[model samples]
Target chain A: MRAVIMHGPGDVRVEDVDKPTLVEATDAIIRVTSTCVCGSDLWPYRGAQKSRGPARMGHEYVGVVEQVGDAVREVAVGDLVVGSFVASDNTCEICQAGFQSRCKHQVMMGSVGTQAEFARIPLADGTLVKVPGEPTPAQMRSLLAASDVLGTGWFAAVAAEAGPGKTVAVVGDGAVGLLAILAAQRLGADRIIAMSRHADRQALARRFGATDIVEERGAEGVARVKELTDGYGAHSTVEAVGTQESMMQAIRSTRPGGHVGFVGVSHGVELDGRDLFNATVSLLGGPAPVRRFLPELIDLIMADEIDPGAVFDLELPLEEAAEGYRAMDERRATKVLLSV
Target chain B: MRAVIMHGPGDVRVEDVDKPTLVEATDAIIRVTSTCVCGSDLWPYRGAQKSRGPARMGHEYVGVVEQVGDAVREVAVGDLVVGSFVASDNTCEICQAGFQSRCKHQVMMGSVGTQAEFARIPLADGTLVKVPGEPTPAQMRSLLAASDVLGTGWFAAVAAEAGPGKTVAVVGDGAVGLLAILAAQRLGADRIIAMSRHADRQALARRFGATDIVEERGAEGVARVKELTDGYGAHSTVEAVGTQESMMQAIRSTRPGGHVGFVGVSHGVELDGRDLFNATVSLLGGPAPVRRFLPELIDLIMADEIDPGAVFDLELPLEEAAEGYRAMDERRATKVLLSV
Candidate 1:
């Protein structure tokens, strides 16, 4: 089997590796159909996070189950499925409370490297949500998104309590942020504001039900949001960028007693306790429990109700995985999908 | 009229002052029946927060309405009332959303000198909650507690989402923290854990419905809570101290997806964004819109369902306001009441 491995900063290579096999009784071997580079992957690619001896890369994938261990019950051979970045045992107390990311028996799909031809998915019965049938090419793209981004965006919106009569503001223009706009719209938010400066992304945001756009960043951006909201700020703000500036903007853009749902992976940012206390806003976020939203996202995709896959501006063959990483790292594409 | 005035840090004196009169169409003049020193007052008293020359002190009071301006409709002269630290026009959008502390027309009662024999309350129609009628000394004490500490504790419990089948952990043993235990019990929390080391406070906490007491701080305190909660941490944690350690303990003592309701006045504490993001806990706190809970709290007190005033361990004549402040500052008393 071939997998994309990173040796050092700005260095990605496709190398042959031993095929994965069922190591646990609950594991399932998946033949990767499609995989993509994630924003978090850029952490190591850009040298923000150190590489740990040629780290196994990707964590998002749409695949077909080729084999299952004795304990796997919900999925079987040849089943098409979408699995989260982390495999979790749904029976755990945390998982039962709708926090699968914090499940007691959890395995990071990143270690298995979903970018490869074959990957072992632990806790298969709880990790994989089987699709209705073989999907169309477009549906395949949406199904791939369900593995992480779309589910994450949906979770952020839900955490922010974005629903009917809410004015929601999204702080990033990445795939997850764009998808959050769609999720907020689906949740019946009266007004959806996407904060983006790029013309192309802003147009997509508008097409995806964004009622407004604030090009400014930080305090200025917060002021603009306040202006638009009659000096009250948005009812709910989604922090899709983990930087200090973005987090502060998300907090400031929300009105007193409003909610700030943050799903961005924080990289050494510090929040001032005094500011948070004085702001009177609720903070809810973290590594999104993607597994919790996979089923609903898959249904919406199959019904053609949402086109989250539009975020994949570039696609490449699995053999050209390096190019996919380069495209996303350079901001040339919102997301880069690899056809395996 | 006489009021406690702070000439500088560590310098408080009782001095004669002009009696307060209606300053606006919505203002009301109240003859204070009782007043108290708050934990937050110690900030300026200890030089943590700067004083602006001969500043009038005290923000918590229960009093009789002596006079009402032309537009003051909800409150009438001779009505015994309890109001929050901040007077808010509860008709505003923010107030209507249950955040009266951030209301558009909010005036800090501290600035109005609630410690004075007579104080002017702004937005009287929205700020004052009338008691059913004049009552005994115990009821008066309980009503005074509702003016700030009890209301804040109730808000913390409400924000923490304490309820039936939930285990609640309180992170402070001060007056507000002790009252938080009572509030959680009133909300039907199955178990209340009060983190306290002081023997007096621990006993008071238990008397106020605390089922357990953990005499540890910071990480160790969180560990103790987790050990008591079957290794999953408490379902709800109330942070009554605003320091970094207390806030972090409150966050760490809660299970993933649990709530941390903080109401302590933040003093120079900074929260690491990375820790907060990774913790996956819901953080909600602020000055506490006490006005929003005034009516219900008053009802509960009038019905004699809960007596939060037991937190006040010392009482003094209004002329000895300095001594009351000294007792609280020296930790000799959890709370001190000054009778007018």
Candidate 2:
């Protein structure tokens, strides 16, 4: 088996590694069908987040159950499935509250490295949501998205309360932000303002139902968004970039009593508590309990209700994993899908 | 007319001032019956928050409607009323959403100096909620509490989503946090934990509804709260102290997916974005939209359902405003009420 490993900053490599096997009674072996690089993965590759020696990479995975341990009941061998970044028992109080990312006995999928020919998923019954049948190529692509990005975007929209009559604004034109626009539209948002300066990403944003665009950055961007919403700012704002500037933009773009769902992996961002207190907005976000939305996302993809796979502008064979990482790092690709 | 004025930090004086008169058709003049010192007032008094020369002081008051302009309809000249620290026009979209404090056309009650013998309340119809008939001395004290502390506490409980089967933890022992216990109990919380080191405040918290008391502060306090909640922390936590340590404690004491309602005026607190993002807790707060809860609270108090005024441990004549401030500043009193 081959897997992606990071030896240090900007040193992602594809190397032959031992194939994974079931080690826990609740674990299942998954033959990786599809996986992708996440924005958070860039943190270590860009040297923003420290990498402790050689690190296993990739958490999002869409695969087939190659084998299952004795305790696995819901997900079975040969079943097509999607799983989140966090594997959990799903019956804990935290999981029941839709925060499986914080489940008491959670296992991080990143630790197992899913960007390989095979991976072991712990708590299979709870972490993996099985697709009913073999999916079309299009459905497979969307299902791969449901493993992380789509579910994360969906959580942001829901947490922001982007429903009928809401004017939603998105900060960061990354894959997740673009998908958040689609999710907000699907949730019946009255309008969506996408903050982007790129022509290509702007086109994709418009295609995903963005009603307006604000190209300015920082204070100017916040002012433009407020101008688009009658000077009251947006009813909801989704922040997909973890930088301090992006976080402030998201918080400032929302009106009083509005909601902000920030999914950005906060790197150096520090929020002014006084600003939040005076702003009168509700803030909710996290790593996103992707497992909570997988079932619905799978059904939506299977039914051809949404095309979240459009985020994947570039795709590569699993052996050329280095190129995929390079393309995303250089901003040449919105998202890069790896077929194993 | 007489009013409390701060010539400088620690320099409070009751001086003769011109009586207020209706300056707008939406205004009403009130003869103040009772007013009180607030925790936030100390911010400037102690020179923590900068103060301009001879600033008017106090925002919490219960008064009689002494005069009304032609346009004022909801409240009459003979009616006794309890108003929020912030005056608002109820028709605005923000107000309709239950955030009257952030109303498009809002007025700070402090700017009008409620501590004065007479106050001109702008947007009278929306700001003042009339009490039914006359109020006794006991009712007057309770209503005065409702004017600020009690209303703020109720908003905190509501914002924290405290209710049946939930465990609530309050992270301050001021008048507001003490009353939050009462509010959470009324909302049907299964258990309420009061975090206070002072024995007096702890006793009051227990009387109000606290099922447990943890005297520890900072990290130890968070650990104690988690131990009490089966290592999952409280389902709802109210933060009523706006320091960095208290804010961090409140965030750490809540379980994932739990709600935190913070009502303290944030002074110098700055939140680490990465910590909150990974915590998976929902945060909502601001200055309390006290008017939203006034009607319900008035009924509750009139019916003798709760006694929030017990938080006021000291009473003084309006002429002794300096002593009142000194008592609160020295921690010699839990709360000081001024009879105007």
Candidate 3:
């Protein structure tokens, strides 16, 4: 088996590794069909997050189940499937409440590394949702997205309460933010505002149903959003960038009593309580419970209703995994897919 | 007319001032029958908040309408009314959405100085809710409570989504928080937890429908709440003391997907975005839209179904306003009422 591992910062290498095997009664061994370098992967690659010895590199994947443990019921041998970044026992009280990320029995796929030839997924019955059949190449790409980004974006939109009559704003132009625009559109938001300076990302945002784009940042950006919203600000905002300024912009761009659903992984940012208190906006965000939305996202992708995989601007062979990481880390690509 | 003015920190004086008259087309002059010192007043008294020279102090009151502007339709002269701390034109889009405090034509009663013998209330028709008729002394006390603390606390409970089968936790033992327990009970909350260390406050909390009392602060308080809630924390948390620690405690005491409604006036506190992002709790709070709940709260008070005024532990004459402030500042009274 081959897997990508980072021994230290700026050091990603794909090398031979021991193959995965079913380790728990709820575990399933899957042969990777495709995987991708996520934006979050840049946290350690850019030396922002501390890395220990030989840390596994990926958590997004589309695969075929090769073996299943005794307790695995939803997936079987040779079944095509999409699994979330976090493995969760759907039977837990938290998962039952639609918060799979906080499931009583949960496992981060990062530890097992989905960017490999073979990986064992814990809580397989809860984590893996099977595709109708072997997917076409484009379908496969969209299915791979369902493993994390699509589900995450959908969760962000849902958390933001973006629906009919809502004017929604996305703070990040990354894959998740772009997909959030699509999700908001699908959820019937009347207006979608995308904050992006990149020409290419802006085009994609427009394609994903963004009704407007604000090229500005901070207070100016918030003002622009207010201008578009009759000076009331957006009714809902999706914060896909977890920086201090971005969070504040998202909060400020939302009208009083509006909702701000933030799904960005906060990178050591602190929010002033006074600002939040005075804004009178509802703040709801965290590690998105992707597993909770995985099934629906897979159904949408399989039904050809949404094309979220357009976020994959670059593609490569699994053996060239380092280049994929470099491309995403350097902002040369929104996402890079690796064909295994 | 006499009014309580804060000359400086730790300095309050009751002095004769010019009686107010209708100044705006939407304003109404009211002869204040009663005014009360709030927990927030202590902020300036203790020098936590800066005060300008001879600034008027109170924002909560019950009064009789002395005069009404040409445009004042809902309220007229000689009407006995209880108005919110912030006067809001309830016809605005924001007000229609139940966020009257953020209405375009909102005016703070604090600036108008309800502590005076006569106060001018702006947006009178939208802010003042008249009682069915003149009432008894006990009913007057409850009606006064409806002016601010009761309405604000009820809004907190509503924002936190307290209802049947839910467990609610209230942070802060002030009038608003104590009233929140009663509001939650009325809203059908199965259990109410009041975080209070004072024996008198705790006893009052229990009397007001608090099912449990946790005499702890910060992390320990959250832990105790979790222990009582089967490790999932409360379904809803109302934060009535605005501070970094209290806000965090309220957030921590709520389970993932739970609601936290905060109404405490923030005093230079910063909330860590990372912690909030990871917590997966919904945060909603601000200067409460008391006007939005005025009609219902007035009904509750009029029916003699609830007595939120029990939180007022000290009563003084209008001339002894300084003692009212002193009692609240020294923590000798949860709340102080000044009869004119």
Better of 1 and 3 by DockQ: 1
DockQ comparison, 1 vs 2, better candidate? 2
Candidate 1 CA-lDDT value: 0.92
User: What order do you get sorting by DockQ, best first?
Assistant: 2, 1, 3
Q: Compared to the true structure, candidate 2 yields what TM-score?
A: 0.98
| Candidate 1 clashes between residue pairs 3 or more apart in a chain or in different chains | none
Q: Which segments of model 3 are wrong by more than 4 Å?
A: none
Q: Across residues B162-234, which tens digit of lDDT does each residue of candidate 1 receive?
A: 9999999999999999999999999999999999999999999998899999999988999999999988899
Per-prediction DockQ, in order?
Answer: 0.84, 0.89, 0.80
Per-residue lDDT of B91 in model 2: 86
DockQ of 3: 0.80
Recovery fraction of native interface contacts for candidate 2: 0.91
> Model 2 over residues B34-76: C-alpha lDDT tens digits?
9999998898899999898798989999989999988999999
Model 1 docking grade: high
Chain A TM per candidate, in order of listing: 0.99, 0.99, 0.98
Work out candidate 1's RMSD over C-alphas. Answer: 1.1
Where in model 1 is the C-alpha error above 4 Å?
Answer: none
CA lDDT, candidate 3, residue B105: 81
Per-residue lDDT for B1-340 in model 3, tens only? Answer: 8999999988999998888877888999999999899888888898898877779889999999999999989888899999899999988777888998888788888998989899999999899999896578888888888888998899899889899999999999999999999999999999999999999999999999999999999999999999999898998999999988898899999998889999999887788888888789889999999988888888888888898879888899999999888888889988899999
Cα lDDT tens digits for candidate 1, A64-142? 9999999999999999999999899988778888889877787888888998898999999999999996578999998
The most accurate candidate by lDDT is: 2
Question: What CA RMSD would you report for each candidate?
Answer: 1.1, 1.1, 1.3
